[model samples]
Target chain A: MLWLTFILAGLATTLPRASFIVLGGRVRLPPTLQRALRYAPAAALAAIVVPDVLVVAGDFAPLNPNLAGVSAAVAAALLSRNPWLPFIAGMVALHALRWLPGG
Target chain B: MPSASFRAGAREGFLAFLPLSVGLVPWAMVTGMAMVGAGFTPVQAMGMNFIVFAGTAQLGTLPLIVAGVPLWLIVVTALALNLRFVIFSAAIAPGFRGAALPMRWFAGHLLTDGVFACCLEKMLAVDDSRWRLGYYLAPSIWSWALWQVFTLIGVFAAGVIPKHWSLEFMATIALLMLLVPLARQRPMLVAAAAAGATAVVLRGMPLRLGLIVAIAVGIGAGFAAEHWQDKEEAP
Candidate 1:
């Protein structure tokens, strides 16, 4: 069953990727729908990320080590184009925050 | 035998992807370790990586799978996380138009966020279809290879890493890197803010249904923001 789930998941991901390419000129997405689709990635990513950082054990906690780390990450990302900078900043901030006395 | 222009394009693509490959290492390793940490055997983890080839969807569905959500629900979640690829495919579809069916299908299957960005940038500057195809494939294959190699390393190293390190959080950080850049524009910023707020409010929803709702709300918010901006700009 697990393997079957993996297969179905693969199909779900690939089908959309293959949709427009395979159908070619036979199909055209409306401009409005295309613009909406452009937001899907950012929105989906935010939906996955926000709760993970803010919610702690079923409670919403505004202040936490995770939030601090993510804030450092966001700052690093804004400052530099290098993807590694933010990743390294986030990990370092996370570890440092966790090590603090009150944390 | 491929032509000289295709070969040149391929070379440029590979070189261009070299710097970006370094960033993928930690992300791929974290993903692999997360899979093993979630109770998947190394073999199972590798199988998932091979078939899925989507880091976001794989990570998004991992917790739900461990919680034993329904299979259909898992598929739906994966699909929703991957909806962005539909836009990517459409953007590059013209380059693949009229190509052989097998080639088109293969290329579409290999499409990814990094590859799409690189391919589109090069496609804008070049007019040759063959060169564009070569440009796309070279980086696509290179990144795919790098991803597999690093993921395998992580799978084996999962046992050595301490659980206290909280390595799964790295996956979240990696995602944040992807998200932060996309949120630079006002409408995108509004979209991300709306989605984040919605997810927090609905965090208690069962089966992670809040994620889907949050994405829907975010897209609507972003579209509304864009429409408003256009109206303000018009006479």
Candidate 2:
């Protein structure tokens, strides 16, 4: 079942991406769904990021360096628009906080 | 002459995607390391990396897999995370109208955010279908190459590095780089904020079920905001 699930996952991913191309634009999605889908990445990433930073070992860890890292990353992303900048800033922040006294 | 044209198209595509490729490396390596740390065997991690070949989808599904969630949820989460690719497909569909079905399908499968942007930029100017296809292929190939190499390196290194280094944080930062810029629209901002709040609030849910719920609610929030905006603009 695990293997079958993986195959289905692949199909689910590839088919939606391939649908418009293979169908040669035959099927036009409704604008509503398309608009909603536009938010999918933001939602997905936010879901991942929130728990990753806030929840540590099944409890809220407000002081985690991950939170600081994410804040720095958000600023960098907003400022530069260069995708790498946030990552570098966040990584440096995360490590710096870890190395800092009482951080 | 045909091969020469293909080579030139490929070169154009490669250089076009080079900047984005530089950004792709750290994320890919983090993914590779995360896969192993999540208890997947090296072979399994690499297989998923190559076969799925999508960083976002793979990362989206990883936590669910690690938690022994139902297979259906795993598949659904990954697929849901990849829903944006449908837009990429539609946008790029007309350009490949003259190509063969199999080739078109192959191109669609290889699509990524960087490659899609680069391809769209060139599609307007280039009339030759073959050359256009070559342009798409070049970046796809290089991106895949870097992703594979870094992922493998991270997978091997996962064993050597102590968990104290907290390499997992790199994955989170990589995700932020992708996510932050995407919240440009009000609807998208609402979706992101809602998703973050839901995930953090429901962090107690078992098997990371809250993440899926958060995604669904986030999309709902975005959809609602858009509908509201449309109604406001209608009059």
- The C-alpha lDDT values of all candidates are 0.82, 0.77
In order of appearance, the predictions have TM-scores of 0.85, 0.72
Question: Model 1: per-residue lDDT, tens digit, A1-103?
Answer: 9899899999988998888888877887776776775677677779888988998898999798899889988898788877678778888899998999988
Model 2 TM-score on a 0 to 1 scale:
0.72
Q: DockQ score of candidate 1?
A: 0.63
Interface RMSD of the candidates, in order: 2.7, 3.8
List, residue by residue over B1-235, the lDDT tens digit for candidate 1.
9878778888888887665556667778988998998999989999999999888788879998999989999998888777767777876676765477888888888888766744665664578877777888898888888889989999999999998887777777776776765788899899999989998998888657787789889989999999999999999
List runs of model 2 lying over 4 Å from the truth.
A1-9, A31-36, A58-63, A78-85, A99-102, B1-17, B38-44, B56-96, B113-136, B184-188, B198-235
For residues A1-103, what per-residue lDDT tens digits would candidate 2 score against the true structure? 5456557767767887887878885776676665565566677678878888888897888788888988998898788857678777887899899899997
Best by DockQ: 1
TM-score (C-alpha) between model 1 and the true structure:
0.85
